[model samples]
Target: MDIELITNILFAMVRSGTPLLLVALGEVVCEKSGVLNLGQEGMMLMGAVTGFIVALTTGSLALGVLAAMLAGVLMSALFGMIALGLRANQVATGLALTIFGAGLSAFIGADFVGKPLVGFAPIAIPVLSDIPVIGPALFQQDILVYLSLVLLVLVWLFFRVTRAGLIVKAIGENPWSAVTLGLPVLRVRWLAVAFGGALAGMGGAYLSLAYTPLWAEGMTAGRGWIALSLVVFASWRIGRILLGAWLFGLASILHLVFQGMGVDMSSNLLATLPYLATIVVLVILSSKQSRIRLMAPMSLGKPFHPAG
Candidate 1:
């Protein structure tokens, strides 16, 4: 393929992958703290609607992103209150959060459906962006693209270098032991959930404010679920999350390429490739029982109680 073709594919892949990367990264942190938030879809939907509404009203992309993050945080906080504070079942509460988010976002965003905002503009670094084929493909992108990469690096360092990260990991491995060690298990878990929610919201904001720039009731589609799968595909590791996101991104963009090239195939069938790919990856990863046990958070989906 020509450089132009290659660049187009690469750019599209990165754009497609960015949101997944953001969501998966946040999930890693949440899971590392023994919180399995199946509410990613709900949090993302709330973010998309809230971000689109705020940005459309204020004409400020920054505010839109902030609103989306706030929406995510609030959704996560609700999950925390139920699952952590009240000692409810994490799985059931997470599912409830998703359902609530879907309904609430649709109700709130009813008026704004189909409206389009100007959205964020791409930024090109002066010298770097001028560097031939690699420039536009790599450097000439929106702020969120770079932010995703930065987040990956920071998260890696957070897990590898920081005491707080270790504590969170320890809690995931054994919350009961963490409590015995006098660690503030519930507090740390809440914070991790908040951080995860913020990132998921940002992922949703990118969908509305950059990817498509229009309001749709379910604009997030199912990226949130894909992101959840990505966490498992990555085996809860930071570096693998980045790779897994790009792999899924490529799968997502394949349908566009097929349609563009005048391939005669059902659009619906092509659309299933990304989701199908997700299922395939999950099956493969799950089959290796020992590996999964080694990687998965031990206390994931289990409610933790200080008084118990």
Candidate 2:
């Protein structure tokens, strides 16, 4: 059925968007707390490898996830230490982490090239999944897809209601006041970065265990970077991350459509759709609201250390 094809496509978009949503959520948290975290790409790639390796070794999905989270935490700490503790340049450190992550994943993943995880099987919700056309498309999905939605609501509530969330925003706006009020700015950032890294790692694991279920060199293929851009495109907001991920997910699925349609084109150009969309969206937003680009962080890519 043609409807089935389109239905499947929509389902794929949700699955594809899940990883981006997870990564962007973390980046949003870090950005909210006044950390740019360029090392997101690196952290993600390392998580991908670690997740893949542990799953292959232990035959346990939960253990693999834990391993991946630990790897992400370790790598993100490296990023935080360089950029935050040492007060190094955020941009430079992030770039270096990206490079290191790419190389390290490639090297470590060499032995596991052909092996892949079995990954999560999709589950259908009771009544909703039984409905006609849209039912299977929207209602039935993997655990991560539903969890992403739950995260959306949880994050929104956190920023809007919680005092800790308020502290994060306050620190981002004015560090001096947060410090004066006895807020542990550095500690907050540390927790934020660690949580963000763990989420990104989970995102990376989703790509391996759920998205592809395979290990390949550079498998993330800039999805990490795209997720990072999405945090900006969403203006460090939670709800917008859902929208942005879906948009990018659609952009990605377009490539598959082109292939299905048998359009003769270079594989390279065909694969560039999602990245192109990221750039185009950035340009459009910049042109539309140069002044009110609500997606931008006021203190992005800036380092902060309390005065002794």
Q: Note the residue pairs that clash in candidate 2.
A: 235-295
Instruction: Give per-residue CA lDDT, model 2, range 222-259, as digits (tens).
Output: 88888988876676778888998988887778677868
Clashes of 2: 1
Judged by whole-model lDDT over C-alpha atoms, candidate 2 comes out at 0.82
- Model 1: colliding residue pairs: none
Model 2 deviation from native, Cα RMSD in Å: 2.7
Model 1: worst 10 consecutive residues (lDDT sum): 285-294
* Sequence-dependent TM-score of model 2: 0.90
Give the per-residue lDDT of model 1 (tens digit) for 98-136. Answer: 899999999999999978688788899899987876677
TM-score of candidate 1 on Cα atoms, chains taken together:
0.92
